[model samples]
Target chain A: MRHLLPRARRGPAFRAAALALALAAVPAAAQEGFGFGEPEAEAAAALPSAGPASGASVGGELSFSIDAFYRAEDEVADLPFEGLAEGVLEFKASGTKVEAFIKLKLSENILGESPEDMLDEAYLRLYLGPHSLEGGLLKLVWGKADSQGPLDVLNPFDLRDLRITETLERKIAEPMLHATFALGDFTKLELAFLPGFEGHRIAAEGPWAPAQVEALELLGIDFEGYLPDTEGLEYAQAGLRFTTSSGPVDWGLQYFYGRLPTPAVVFIPPVSLSLSYDPYHQLGLDAAAVFAGFNLRAEAAANLTEDLEGDDPEVYNPSLLWSLGFDRDLFGGINLNLQGSGSFRLAEEGVGEVAYDIEADTERTRTRVTAILSQKLRNETIEWELRALYGIEDADFYLLPRLAFDVGDAEIEIGAGIFGGDEEGELGQFAESSWARLLLSYEF
Target chain B: MKRLALLAAVLAAGAASLGAQGALGAEEIVRASRDRIQADTVSSRSRMMIVAKDGSATERLVDQYSLDAKEGKRTVIVFQKPASVAGTRFLTVSNPGRDDDRWIFLPSLAKVRRIAGSEGSGSFVGTDFSYDDISSSDREVEEDTHAILREEKLEGKDCWVIESRPKDPSFQYTRMVHWIEKGSCIALKAELYDKKGLLKLLEFSQFKEVQGRITPMATKLSNLQANTSTSIAVEILKYDEKIPAGVFTPRYLETGRPQ
Candidate 1:
């Protein structure tokens, strides 16, 4: 079924003159295949050198990027220049009932710290009738919302580069075992277990460094010394999710038990700082549906932390988090996506004693709105996009405008990120770090 | 065969003296043209070339699998070349009286996303063909009103010039004019008109027999307004293959496995 445009809504003419076309419908008896000459013959010869195999393939990509700060010098001087080179290799092999994939990445930051090489994901899947099992270091997304949804908390984030937002670029894969039981055509039950904990990574001494560190040091406190060890068995996590469809809406319910990915800071009575990871139980519900032409998604979660009664000074209080979003094409092929997310603490009486580097996490109630406007031109060979994030409570905002050109297997992207508003707010904390970047990549 | 009935009808009613019989003959001819090829499942690998107005060109490699299902027709298309889109897959399932259900899987996302059926007007992977054009082959003959415009020789063959106006007023095309070869009952050329007049010209060629079924192995669509065109030529094709039912599911779209 094709998605045909309503006749009355047809856009204006593509151009002026209507040229007569020469139809090439040669008689079958005389010509071999409606012979349209060499063009068609050339395309037929462009096929792969090798024929189809038993589904085993290897491919990779190589990329390089450079960032140039353009903010005022008076503001905290941002990094003069930052460059990165990355290479990725993927191997995939499949069988009738089993499949395996390995993705290896080698990333080198020329202007930063140590270069690292690692396996991004190496997983094996076993198909058993209507159920399947997967294991290895894996990365998974768990929410319906396109943006920051509370239910998508399965993996820790890589916050070292605050300018990145795409989940694929910002997520940190972890070791896990996952299983899915197909209950019906549109229903499934999933179980996931992570044997260890990996917290979000934040830069220690860069333009993107946490603002809380500076604030604590100004008060004569050594912030890093108080960080608690998180390598113990108690930090493991597990979750279960059930997804099904009702009418036109797809919905899911999930429950997870794990330690918070971000640590909470509290002040001790005797002039000391306490930083620790608190265990929590999260119950979430998510749904996605299309109404009219809009794709709508929503997610809500209640996180019950150790400070349920609001009596623990070093633990976080329980909170309710929610996100709602929708995406639709406005007109003339331009698309718009908007999302709003909020977190409301159930009992905030005990959390005021400490300050959070991330302003949204410290408030009793915090709300933020994100929007993305994008357009594709030249039959999708070129794309222009603008993304914005606003902190409703802190009066802070961040804007990112990008343009990309796709040339066969290569792509070139140019973009800039700007931050403004309350300097202490989550996004505004990097107000002086605004910069423009150029990225180029090619895949094979 | 349907082609024989079309020929018989046209011969019984003298071409120049026919009126209402001409319209019925047109519909029968169009139906016969579409029903000429029948298969339980069809699989093919093709190479497509997009030529720009400036004469520059790019190519893509693709694999397509199609089968008839209880719900309707089901298809899966996978991109193999042009690394930027490699590993991407799309699934579409026809739903009789309702809009088709569609989904896409982008390797970067590692998840499946449902696509709104209203995006039919959009280009297919930046090519000259629109999403609607991908499924046009399955459009029912009854969806449009047909009439024989005239009979003429097209490159040495006596062909019927037929005009078809969509029954749905909201269809993208205002009308489509076809040049069908008489003996084979195969549409060799089609002129698709938008509100502004001639919009795109489509030609089918490379007729071949696969598993006792006649099939068109090449297609070219040219956008007159933009002076650009895309040509797809089948490198390999097979009919009536046994494709597992699981290959059409969302799970298969995501995992690339027929589980």
Candidate 2:
């Protein structure tokens, strides 16, 4: 069980690509989370007599977006130009809901490698009272906020580069069951469970494997020839959130816990890969407040996990990780956001330190800072935003600038970004890269 | 008719002395109340409880509001209850000296229906209070002639009692007596009368301070004839945020979502 961690970490690109396809195929008609529009007093007027009975109400919204980018690299690795497109459809009836999503990668011209092109993300949802059942391929949201940390099920997209990160691409959707209950005026409780099954499970030797060894080549990560077959996995999560208002102060707090399965295979001599499953635990908290022209939001999460072997080891010990961030409005529509997070390995034999020497029990921390300026045109429908991010651990900086224009029923936007960092294998060699893209979306 | 003459004589005497001292004079009090009502338009989240004649009750969360004088044309946006009218956006535009123009955006039907002014006197959203009661933000000062009644203490708060008679016979209420807070100039209570001089509805509640402005944050309006009442509590008050002008447009109401 412990030996499969390296392999699981190797193949992120394939996973990311697959997740993207799935997201695109998702229908736009799915029920969005909570939303409230401005309220007005009812007119002091009488209504006319009732009309003929109409059938039950039904409606939905759809969105489609595509990203294209080109990169100039010294050695031109596997891919330099990539194109991605995604579409979503959502519908609701009798308060019941259904959604479908699809994601596709049209072309990738890199260092000359053409993989089997494909489709991703197909699922459906049904709501019965307090319970919602989901099937096919689906992304599950867990925790109070920031599903990215340890329980993220969806791939994270990089709009400027038209690419999704390799690290986050491996999250896949399986059949799941979810439920929500109103705790009170200011609070709600939700729970979800997912059971692992055959067709959904990735086999160690199948042509379409969960984690492909070849995909990890770019990251310089390699796993020993041992291929582990996973039997199944199970996940459960719960969250509670509450909101309250007193005078000008409005605020809320949320807490969540998720336990997710991590499947791996280990091949012993003369025997095919044997599947073993380990689960990871995640806990998170989120809080927000709005007053005057100011808004504040903050979130944090911690991941807990144990090595597959019950006994403690020394070299590559597992660790608990946490992340936190805050955002505030400066003036007009301008806002400032700052975030920092780090991971620390708990002291254990044969696990805590390997490649780098460390104190028997020590914590490693990474931090990042970002600043953004946003402005809303007084009488116009256009808005603009500029942002910059600096990563402390990697000593890298990224700049993102975007402009959005409202055009009747749709919104059109253009954006550009640049990233500068130290080159790989070289201590002080610096490098820089940039990309740009455009997007159009409509809501009904 | 003779009783009306006697009441008029008494009001004249009260006005003459009150005007001479200029201390909370009848005219001054009425002017202050009108000015306060016109100062700011408020958007509030209200929980409305409707009690029926049989003592049964229904509760709903209503997003109700009015734009301040600065907002120019009077506008109101009412959100429908989650169960019956979820996604319903209703808008009413009031024109001076004329009946307000009304439209209801039904999300279920995806259509905007204009409401005739004749229907304005009907109960609002199944509550005992008429829609007129809800949109009376700009009730003209001259529409009702005010006569300072007296100084009194009600519900542990000091108030000014004043009688107001509708200048227009078409107005639903014949006369209304208001309890106004001397400091905030907000009407803390009101008693409505029918054309026959019979008590009709009673409204009373103190103004709660929200975002530096004093407003009637909670109100209890009772219908004497129907033996029913509605109590509304407004929470989470925010002022002057960048709300899209489209949010107030008729198109937005019908869609239930802003563009």
Candidate 3:
């Protein structure tokens, strides 16, 4: 874990104060109270008693948004780590029959690497009588989980340039065809077909791959790039999701037959390693219900892969995952969400793999608890959010807190991320990755 | 025509038989108010201002398309705003005997999400209006028992003050009161009382005749306890507008047009 852990970027309180000052620089309107939601759009009018009838509108809406942010880090291990700058520009438009969206992200290291440009999403959608068909690059999300769910599988996420925390938006969109049909008033059926597969843009080679790779190397586990010859059309993917709501409850049943997002690194003795994404079938169920001002959601999935018996230590076994969560608003404009999730491996006992002890084989059942508390003020123009992820079984946790102020179309905020726990725990392994940042963005 | 004639006959006989004592039932008053402005289709755009107790105000722009369906009314609302809420759309289909079906498309999610029944009590995008509040205007007239409380003069016009109590004990509002213009039968004011007492007051004004149709162009909902208020000002309104047939479906929520 130590060798694979990404070194943390730390900074002094002075840097944090500087970021805070920058955040407070925005001028606020002289008003007493605030609320949240779409502030730009408004409605009201005095209708004409009688006048010429207005013609139907066949045109659409068009808008462009620009967002940029900078963050300063704290000192880590007596060394100064430069911060980062990020920028994104998006163009969107949707008519009665068509929809289009495109976005580009630019990332740069304050003291290091050059700016890198990424094409985030470029997609178009069409509405066809009770059915919707979308093609081009698409980001598809499934499941009703508050946080990440084992069932919310579709887009393989690439790490955010500034991966300070985890969010569902980390998804990487790829070319695919998505169709949704309304079975009736209360039900919907969705289908997705992928001509090709897109695996996670996870770590591969050298120094930038995080220090943890060295430990794996010490254990004779070496990782290689994707097999160039395996990029054939046979490796496609498809998925189906059926959703319905009755009374107070909403639920969805989904199925997907595709290769896993993360590849399993095959270990064949010293100085040898290769990567392969094992094909698997997954069955998922998700539901959400609101009661007493609280929204409760649950998601569960059973995966079938190569190693059902679990005896083959090298090949990962089938897995089972479940998540339960709730969201509610409390006094003082505060919203709180909490979730408990667990993952289990389905493997037969005594199925014999002697290379490593069962305890250290990395096949143990894991559980975690996560929470998000957010408060809004001045009508929702100013919001402060705190998120925490705790590994229940490993006793490790990570905390991220931020303050954001929305000035019309622009926003500014500064905050720090904290990580602590057992070195063996998931988040604890990145204890040193704690960093503080300031963000600013504008939409037009 | 038959229903109106029957209603007129009933009113005339009641006026004679119970001259001093009001004979108008709660259901009749409500039905009259609900049907005062009748059209096959309705389309309008308006500006809304939400004011906080401290006097701060925010504005929103929206367009609404309402079509009369066999079961009830189907309405689609699209936010045309400063930008934050732009491209957001909401569709609600009325169900006569049961609850309505509602769906929303948030620009942020880029997908349509079905709103569950439990969410009906929640606020409508941070506004004073709740999901239930918006649909309550078309709520089944029979769901509650209505009775005319008194006949009084309001603003120099004869008016019927009515009270209604829901058949369901667990309804959000314990009781409701309405001030309906006697001749026009248009509800000019309403008050909702919850368990804690007086909750809200909704007022309709800016009465105008559109193509022989009487329409209230403005509405203000005030939250008594919260000291917050929201007012809707209709900017462009037209009756019997030829709205695209597809506007009533969920596809219209996401694509802005129906197939």
Candidate 4:
């Protein structure tokens, strides 16, 4: 059997640093003493009394799920059944001048796979008059769009499984220092610096691995994935953003210096290939407004990669990316959200670059459109939704339909993913990975 | 006999003139009743109970900060309970001539989103109260024309029954009737009517004096068509608190902290 393998793992020291960053937030919260206050009990005690200006709380959620799939092709060795359990523990505290939050995710596959436990986010914030300073492992969202925005580049994504597509669920937080200063009435200036670097988390040696890796192995070639070195200061990223409001519209201007998280293939002689991340600079603009009962969001960014002239075959070319979308309520309480995004490659005459091309079909402009329709019934206890994504240039599409209902403090959700179109398209590669899922979760 | 007749006619004319003037006084009474409590700032923590049609209810803890700014009234509300909606914040700033500006931050979204002002009639987080109902206490007096319907005794207290019709055709309610306590100027009860007749009923009770100001500590809004009701009982209430100016901005809504 052929397999795609990762050539690197983060060192123990880096793990310790991550642990320390998470642990450091505990003391700030511990000073106030952790209390598991029952929300119902606290709210029932309606007393007119003055309480302390500081407090701490601990809470979490636990969920279990089962997934089943039907295979149509032998893309990879098929195992149709999987079971998993996940938990999230969170600690939060706030004082008159300081606040802290820490959250951790614990997951275990009941099928006997190794557990994947990680810190979701841990941050300490200090308030100084009209300004604030926060530091720790954090996930900073920068764009105004509802999803898949062009300017939301601060965090790397976890793409090990294509089934998980929620924006917050897919983001991988990084260590950073973020500060915001109030600039008059409806304006703010924000600055952020990430001291270390990390890239997207992709699975190795599985049906969920990148399709390129699997196709190359089928043709008698070896594929390897390399993690970027995090020890150097050269990999650090920094950004600045200015946000303000004019009339009913809110807009922001941002500039960032960072490495693109997407992996690019580098051809090694003697029938070898490796994936690497390339450095890039991005200047972006985002705006949001409500017009005639519709919420409209737009974001545009100019990504200047190392291959500005598009002459280097190994490096990805510079591109202009934009997204426009609107959210509105239609036909009673049902909501409809639509977004269209496009990326236009600059100097597209490059010799060796393929976006969705397994057969060397390079397109200068790639467009994708997404739509989501959702409704809540029975006092918001029952939720039904349908989400669709279509790649215009690649002629591929993905559809997800879900139904969720609440019963006695527990929510049960059943969903299915369907993929179709050209086999070489980005989403179509997962045609065989399409699956149905059932999840039951409870929160306290 | 002619002199006696003239006296009766003069008395009748005097009564008609006074009745005509009484109609003009209704607007002032409404203006005074709505603006009864004058405070520079208000901060409070309250428990919201959303009762379903089946009588099962859920509670949500909320913190609210409000201030009368130079531009207009500004208010912020933060949710701290139910786990699912914790850390959700909303900010609304009233504009003089245009529609108000509103923004909301959802923990799941992790960013502040601008919402349209036309959602005034939408339900407030699955509650019976609408977005306009939350800010109805601060509605401008001139927006609606009011008339004194009659004087009646409600719960052994004299109240002026007034009928109000909004000038803006787009208002969620076609007309409303309010029962205002005579001396306190507090609206004890109100019935809102839509195009399809009676829609909802609102009642305010549990009057208390905080910082020498008469405040209602309990409020309930019931949707007649849905057979559901939401009640908010204040756990802690304060008046004229020192709320920072930065607390009303979108930044505070996103961060859940001042500035």
**Taking chain A by itself, what TM-score does each prediction score?**
0.82, 0.57, 0.77, 0.86
By DockQ thresholds, what CAPRI class is model 4?
A: acceptable
Q: Which clashing pairs does model 1 show?
A: A3-B120
What order do you get sorting by DockQ, best first? 4, 1, 3, 2
lDDT tens string, model 4, B13-55? 1111111224346777777665556667767777888888888
Instruction: Point out where model 4 deviates above 4 Å.
Output: A1-52, A72-79, A95-97, A110-117, A205-207, A217-230, A268-270, A352-360, B1-24, B167-170
- Of the candidates shown, which would achieve the greatest TM-score relative to the real structure? 4
The regions of model 1 sitting more than 4 angstroms off are: A1-56, A74-79, A110-112, A115-117, A217-225, A268-271, A349-361, B1-24, B167-170
**Native contacts recovered, in order, as a fraction for each?**
0.35, 0.00, 0.14, 0.51
lDDT of 3 at A334: 71
**Residue by residue across A313-333, what tens digits does model 4's lDDT show?**
777788999999999888557
Model 3, span A35-143: residue lDDT tens: 1112222221232332222111111222222222222243335533444455554545444455556555545431233112144566667767667899876777688
Q: DockQ values for all predictions?
A: 0.22, 0.03, 0.14, 0.29
**Per-prediction TM-score, chain B alone:** 0.86, 0.80, 0.84, 0.86
Q: List the global CA lDDT of all models.
A: 0.71, 0.45, 0.63, 0.73
Q: Candidate 2: DockQ?
A: 0.03
Q: Give the TM-score of each candidate.
A: 0.85, 0.46, 0.73, 0.86
Candidate 2 vs candidate 4, TM-score winner: 4
Better of 1 and 3 by TM-score: 1
